[model samples]
Target chain A: MSITKRIIPCLDVDNGRVVKGVKFVDIKDAGDPVEVAKRYNDQGADEITFLDITASSSNRKTILNVVEDVASQVFIPLTVGGGISSVKDIRALLNSGADKITINTAAIKNPDLISEASNAVGNQCIVVAIDAKRKANSPNGISWEIYTHGGRNSTGIDALEWAQNMELRGAGELLVTSMDKDGTKQGFDLELMKAINDKVNIPTIASGGVGTLEDLYDGIEKGKADAVLAASIFHFGTYSIKEAKEYLSKKGINVRNTYD
Target chain B: MNIIAIIDYGMSNLSSVEKATKYVAPNDSVVVTSSPREIDNADKVIFPGQGAAKNCMESIYDKNLDKIIKKNSKEKPFLGICMGMQVLMSYSEENSGTNCLDIFEGKVKKFKTRKDTKIKIPHMGWNKVSKKNDHPIWYKIKDESYFYFVHSYFIDPIDKSTVIGETKYGDIFSSVIARDNIVAIQGHPEKSSDTGLQFLKNFIGI
Candidate 1:
């Protein structure tokens, strides 16, 4: 049997509530994160990811509580990211019902965190998220640089090289987000996704800039992504998870039939 | 008492399994414990685990749960998940070769993918599993239904009769093995969707 392509609904949570924004700004409240997650679970979402966008030291406990709440209600694999810095943090999140922990900012600060966390926990549970933007003026025509702090700080690190290093450091999966296409409703950055997918042997998830059902298919067909994650389109009811899967199925892409 | 014991040898997230069990059988007591005595006292047992095989074996060895699990597997209905299923094999190729409980005659081999294979390791995400034989545990879950899977290694049961479900990832392998009173799956049914929960519900019913 063919492996089914995954369609993930991501919740950018802030202070125990789900939030949505356009291009990471002008944020607005969506609804109760737990209720929203349960709805997605019913809709046949392959998995759910919660990113604590405003994850601060004070709100860490709140996020953990939120994760616990979501885990108790929803049965799909839950991946949590944002403000996670150390193995202790990763452990806490995993214990609080997160199936996988995504590290981006802290991983940028200390690259060894990926190796260390993978060594402590199995690589299957560690996901290194890379927020990247296409750089046209770089030495090579095809290049992207890494961004940290919610896509604010620009680092000169090459996106492709960073992806390779993360794999070497024992990352089980990579959540590659194209900042340039994020929240634009334009579609995924297929070039950036193809660049990383060709370089890494691990499962890669294409995130950001998903507007239509066609974009979801392209992310897997053209970009060679193992999974696709989205926020606004799913959160605002622009499309249901069932509709997306049925559309993919009609397009000849293998998707898990929830109705069957 | 109809208590369902989910053995927690300090590996894996037992909460989801516990929640799924509770969701399916609200009246039954679902406890996550590493205590051998509790495992023996329970009416049914669910053995679940994750992480490296070496570490998992070490935990099962340290807790002295291997014998209890083996003894209970023959006495009552037992279900295993992911790493839980691997430890039942004779040996695993993870962490530079780790010996297992040898409950079943098989070995766990890593997914060796060539450059042209085009299949990613750790086979994470959803895949369709086809039933091999008729059994109570296969109740409502449709034939060749989709289930969530995440692993680099798949169990190779020496006795094909023990394999009740099969899935293909680069190569055909045993995804669910059942014989007598025990049933195990490589997929995480707790994380799978409604159909996955239905598997757990069927297990509890059996």
Candidate 2:
């Protein structure tokens, strides 16, 4: 089978509305989650990932409604994440038409959650999200620490090792975000991605530091990631999904062309 | 109304293919159906696929689509994209347990590359396609136009005349094949840009 490169648009939802921040500060309300999702879908995004950045706190019910609204309108694959902790939350999201559920803080807090969710739903339905920051100490010495509460707290677990364990525990995919690179537009942390991907068998999506199409190419080509996920670049109209795919295609990177 | 029937066999990327088809063939009829009867009656047929070659062929057999495809290919325009195109070859080296559609006289072999190269196992990227035969599908696509490619195996046609386009990875490989009413592209037209869209339009016109 041909492995098609996926162009994923990530919607970070806060209080049921799409919001984006630079360096995770001064957050501005982007728009309604459902409306923004519809626009991405219409523009030919291969997949839509809705990250309920505030689901752990207030607006839990609102996230469900947002998922339902977007899921109903968008015909493409929808992956919901953020604040997805328990099996019941996964079941609810899946029942609401989410094709996959991504777990981060919950998985790190209780590693067994990966196996539990996989068993309840299915391995393919479970995506383990790893939010990491590069630390000065440690071998590869770039620490694979896990961040929680919308990337505010760091759990001192090695990110690469934890990713390997998650795959062993039955995560069908991994979403590795470089907290250091998030919203930076510098480019994806290729070294960090390669480290995690090298250890895990499941598909890994490299998040953060996606400034240009070259960054995406480097993420997949050099980092060996299965997919590249970005927010501000796509959200702020730095580049449309079509433009990104075309650039990737021209560079001889396998991407699903929107024009096709 | 140029109704295009996408042969659905429970594979990945079908939804994306359907959406792209709708974009290009807007105002025309487009639907995903597994029924042989519906496929036989459609104006045109698109076989979009992803997954193991064996499983895809098995799905076709389970649905009794082999005979339907044989009948339709001779009668109407049939386009196969990616793995859909690979299935058209005589056989595939991927998992020797299953037989392929064998529509084209070629064998699908795994790509062989030198260790010195940084290229990965699965040839994934937007590679240029060198057009050979001036088929209708090549319309508006300039010589050596790039199309998105993602596959580990490629078709080696015994009858070189059937090869319409070639792409290079470790070596030049058949990227597009055409024979009578059957046209298949290894790269995704749905994912390709204006050139890829134009190819779809030409195929629809055919």
> Chain B TM-score for each model?
0.98, 0.96
In candidate 2, how many Å is residue B152 off? 3.4
List, residue by residue over A172-235, the lDDT tens digit for candidate 1: 9999999999989889999999999999999999998999999999999999898999988877
lDDT of 1 by residue, B48-115 (tens): 98888999999999999989999999999999999999999999998889999998988999998776
Q: DockQ, in order, for the candidates? A: 0.74, 0.06
**Candidate 2 chain A: 10-residue stretch with minimal lDDT:** A21-30
The DockQ value obtained for model 1 is 0.74
Q: Worst ten-residue run, lDDT, model 2 chain B?
A: B117-126
> Model 2, which residues run further than 4 Å from truth?
A1-10, A13-18, A21-129, A135-142, A146-149, A152-157, A162-175, A183-191, A194-206, A209-230, A233-260, B112-114
lDDT string, candidate 2, A1-260, tens digits: 23567778898788778777322122233476666766675566777898886745756877877876765555556789877779998878775657678988788788898988776655666888888887876764455677876579978787877888987887878888898888788898888999887776566788988999899999989998888898888877888888888888899876655465
Q: Where does candidate 1 stray beyond 4 Å?
A: A21-30
User: Taking chain A by itself, what TM-score does each prediction score?
Assistant: 0.94, 0.91
- For candidate 2, what is the DockQ? 0.06
